[model samples]
Target: MEKDWPSGFPGINWLGRQEEEAVADVVRKGALFRYYGPQSPTHVDQLEEYARTFYDVDHALAVNSGTGALFTAMSALGVGPGTEVIVPALLWVATVTAVIQNNAIPVLCEVDRSFNMDPEDLEKKITPRTKLIAVVHMAGTPCDMDAIMRIANKHNIPVLEDCAQCNGGSFRKRKVGTFGKVGMYSLQINKNVTAGEGGLLVTNDEKLYTRLVAAHDLGVPWKKGLPDETGEVCFWGQGRRMGELAGAVANIQLRKLSHVIAHMKASKQRIKDMLGHMEGVSFRRLNDPDGDTGPFLILMFDKESHAGGVAQHLTNGGIDNVFHLSNYGLHIYHNIRSLVEKVPLSPAGNPWSLSQNSDSLFEYGKGTCPTSDDLFERSVIVTIPSRLTDEQELEMTQAIKNAIVANVTS
Candidate 1:
């Protein structure tokens, strides 16, 4: 029989009176949208300010969703039809969709044990057509940015760091998002800090910052009605601004970020100490192990079959969240139908089969990245709750140990 889990295993209360008052104040004033006019409320500005200060960047642009940030960043970087962008194969499908939305071809790259883009493969995928290299900081662990940056500089290719899953994570004392030319973070419900559904894009370039603001706000130049306006500031754009209420809540959440990260790091370290010595079970390798944000605890097995059996044992023990990612729900990368066929971006199917990508060698299928395929097949992931206690961490660690012993001992 399975051991009973802790009360907070599934989830625990995270939001409190702070978020309550923020939303209440926004609703009371009826200022539900972010705008730059003098009469506009300061909620969005405050949120952006907090992000800028936290990330230590010159600018931060808030948008409707993480995917929106990616799309807007792509647009700001001048990615359009025929542009080739290199991306990691092991990432949420939204990353690929962002490239397609910009009418660019996504050149998928292989990932190392860190579950981030392998620099060697990234370099090999680059060609004259390559315009940008988008990297995901998978599972709250930073990629080998030093190597990635060297290759990017050598090729003169810009890089966009997707910090959606790894906000506040760092490498060698440097934060994950700030390593690239542009970095994007998600404020979705499940993220480290959330505003229901919002995104933040950070960059040090002032010109790119201006373009990002216009790109997400329908190209209405800042201070359009002011006397400083020069020829009405025209630029192509897509309306994807984050709502004011999300901004308000996210601002408050930002205050709690440091405290939350501290707790998560402690909990993750406790779990690691408990389970690190287990035979035949190992955690995912990180270039900087101390930098992991502890969003999820992943275990790699000796064999794919062993991983599958352990997952089954966990599920049989009433732990339904244990996932063998090879066939896991929503995380599957193999044989994705969307990548195999042309994506529907517009009514006319403009981007996928457009003449611009006619000569591009875009390929996606089972064997696209053999390393990623092998890694996912042998991996079993258990999501670490945002709030966890020592007792709960031990229970989770023991549960995994029990499952492995019961299923993989033979």
Candidate 2:
């Protein structure tokens, strides 16, 4: 009999005494608040310290959520009205929403076979109003950071890396987040590491770090556990601070990230090797195979009908979390209703109709990116669980092969 397969909750599979003890210690110490409490709080500070070292960055800030980190980073990088931020089509809704939330226009760039920001399309999207390049490392794979950075440098545009789905992933040995001006990671339950819910920001620029710190909290940089009134960086903070409770769990989870990623990567590679080459199916291109965190496997088919048929066959064969790329919801650029319809933040008709943003008009929806649309219609994405026994891996491999043979070879 085949063993039961695990879901895509990578870090949760490894959770045990460590997380429990960490959380219990915080509760017992009465340090629920990160800044101050009955007992001196240290978990959030320690988490930031460890994150700085883990990502090899000069500074790291713990925030309330991945979305919060995006807003904070964008604000710090000067993404505001009249500016445009270029982003890949195959990104989470939050990535584009962040650009719009900053009162900036979001320009969608086409993703290549790697399912990452196509450096070529990214260049064509840049204009005089372009302010930031928001590169999202989608589905546990890093973008081509070298090519992206080269373009950004040529145009003097700062790059903000959205590493929410690809935490612990790297490109060409350098970590994904470190290559950009700032990198953001999510600690949500579905991420590689879980803190229940939290986020982190990392950067090497001291001035930018100061701005991020201020923007994420009370609009003033904190010094020695207190908000510094005389600080150079000050803005209207959104009050997005990570409490000690989340920090406690996130601190422990971050330590186990590498181990979790290693297990998942090994399992994914083994399954892919077993499948080999199917007549009509091809694996999504990996920019750096060794650098992939490996929580998802994207299979491209020659036809949309073949992909849909394969997806249904996989579901019937008990393969969990299978999705036809077009129906993958908000992850596809055209499926984001608010973006496609150009929904404004308020009734003010701002961001889109504002005088500053008048020249940056662009359309959204299905036909916005023909190249990406073709790829999406003919692709299927399968979730790769973090922990898979030998038997389970074999079962998954056979299930995928059987699905393809039944749908494509038939």
Candidate models: Cα lDDT each: 0.80, 0.92
Clash count list over all predictions = 0, 0
Q: 26-109, model 1: which lDDT tens digit per residue?
A: 887777766643335567788888888888898888899999999899988989888898988788888888888788888889
Residue-level lDDT tens digits of model 2 in 194-220: 898899999999999988989998789
Task: Give candidate 2 regions above 4 Å deviation.
Answer: 1-4
TM-score per model over all chains: 0.93, 0.98
Q: Determine which window of 10 residues in candidate 1 has minimal summed lDDT.
A: 4-13
Query: Global CA lDDT of candidate 2, please?
Result: 0.92
Candidate that would win on TM-score: 2
Could you tell me the TM-score of candidate 2? 0.98
In model 2, the clashing pairs are: none
Error of 1 at 218 (Å): 0.7
Q: Give candidate 2's error at residue 41 in angstroms.
A: 5.3
